[model samples]
Target: MNKLWGFIVAYFLRWFPHGLEPGLRRIGNPGPESPVLVSGNFSLTLKRLIRSLVGQDLWLLVANSRGINVWCAAVGGMFTHHNVIAAIKTSGLADQVRHREVILPQLCAAGMDVKAIREEAGFQVRFGPVRAEDLPAYLAQGKKKTDAMSRFRFDLRHRLDMLLSNNTMFYLIVAIPLAIFWPHRLLAFTLLFWAAAFYLYLLFPYLPGKTGWSRSLYSALAVVLAIPAADFFRAGQPFLHYGWMIAVVLVFSTVGFDAAGILAAMPSDAEAFLHRLGIKRLGSLLQEKTLGRVALDREKCRGDMICYSICPVGVFGELDPDKKITLPWQNACFACGACVKQCPHDALSLQPRP
Candidate 1:
């Protein structure tokens, strides 16, 4: 793939599902004993993962995900165990590898049926680190994914990347209407969006509220109040800046509201809110949670720490000396069910809110 072209498409046009061919790809040189991995056919995910897999001898089974990323595809029912089974059966990976172990991305835990995959494909599924970059270190450390690897970080760089990707289409579509009607404000509109987006994403962590929607309201309030402040600074002159205030409020509201969807931790908050407003078809896609609080069964506990190891929000506390688990961060769970799904002993569960 042309690296530049791949980068452009992945960032700019990701809203559209685009893909590379699905099949088995070899990284470095692989033998029959090499480790096996799985990924979706999304071009960007493929590009990033290939970089992480370089200089390693392994088999990457690219499953068909309708050109979407693994996490989205899995939850959407496109990259189920059936996809893995088909890839394994058709790609001749079983014949090529002696081991039946496949390191699937951990984010797909909500959608993948580990037992079903093993039963159908004869491959034991081991969910890998949440991010592709951790793969190299996870492999180096004898295929162990550290707790740090499972946690998600919306750092400045990644947040900026998300800002660019999420807003590219929004701007592209909005730019035309602005240019046609409000030609003079077009530059101002573009600048305002960039400014609001950068402020919201860059300062996301420091912003108040557990959910992105909540955090956005504060930002929108600030923007709404800024127009009066500007007037105050202009020696009490009436600037009639209400239009710009309205613009800023809308921009901040739009950016902040979207923060929930783009952000890993708050992915469900906005969607759930929208769902409550009766957009069931769209909101239920990823945000609606039928399950409630996550609970652990003490009698069945093996303390394998699978739940602790796989949680993106660090809800499951550290393992106890007696090999039991704790839920010190219970409120953080978005009900994605990664822990419940990956728990080996069936000890973890989701309890309805009381």
Candidate 2:
């Protein structure tokens, strides 16, 4: 029953950032020589990490990230060098561990500065595998990450997981107002919204568009067309039929805009695309472009390949032994700042695009 309740809440009320207490936690009765791993204070993430490390003897340092997952918190600037240092200092981890190394989740590389952490807290940060499930194998392999473990894949499972986790909050917030104000159309709207969501997620890769916004908009249009087609088949009054159709289109289009924000690799561009669609009344969908082009200072680069392994998107090219890091496709950069933050020599920076 507890598990059932957690599942429902995770799917429905996940927007609320439920966080755990920030401190050092001993997993499986670890001693001073045990490996130390650090993560954000998101409740679900903590639970998953605990489950993954059930039999392992290690130290877990939980940093305050306002209850957001590592990747989102890192990208949103909630998880950073300061948070890591705070966790280390507050937890008294320096006195507990003999080794100076701490394992951080690979996703946190976007915002976490290894140099800053080493300077402030006296700990060397080593990035772990992308997923917690791979931690056992990662440890067994002497903490060596395979290429597949480092790379981020947005496959069907990942897309569906993201869809369910994100839509849970959307449903709770939108469902109440919809039932209270437009009770007559509540069921229709709810069903249409979910149907459009599934279509967009399931057909994400094959959807006809260059950008996430375009693909979601196309999917929303496909679902919205059914309303008019149904009206035509029933030979309903034109005024009533078109009015209902307009309402449905407006609601679905708004949802499409929301989906664009969640599913798009570059959310700022998605917002711009929605603006082009004449959507001006979006309450929270307006994300301004704060990060510009990711720049590499070749003279400072040491060719460490840390950025190459950490980037979720293939933004950085393969590192040649003789050449510095090259930006072959800067347009594909998501501006997560992982490469910039993890660069050992501080060779990478984000410059405002001209």
Worst 10 residues of 1 by lDDT: 280-289
- In the range 1-354, model 2's lDDT, one tens digit per residue, is 966765565554555566778999999989998999999988787898899998999999999987778887777677898999999998899899898999999988888878889999999989999989889899989999987888677678777876767665666577789798989867876886687677776777777877666776666567567767777677863344666566556655555554544554543554455446765433222423335668888889888787888876667887666678777777666677788877878898888666
Clashes of each: 0, 0
The C-alpha RMSD of each candidate to the native structure, in angstroms, is 2.7, 3.8
Q: Clashing residue pairs, candidate 2?
A: none
TM-score of each: 0.90, 0.85
Tens digits of lDDT, candidate 1, 152-271: 776777788788777676677878998999899799899998988888888888888777877877887877787788888886854578888777777777777658656656446655
Q: In order, what lDDT does every prediction score?
A: 0.79, 0.75
Candidate 1 whole-model C-alpha lDDT, 0 to 1 = 0.79
What lDDT is reached at residue 245 by model 2?
A: 61
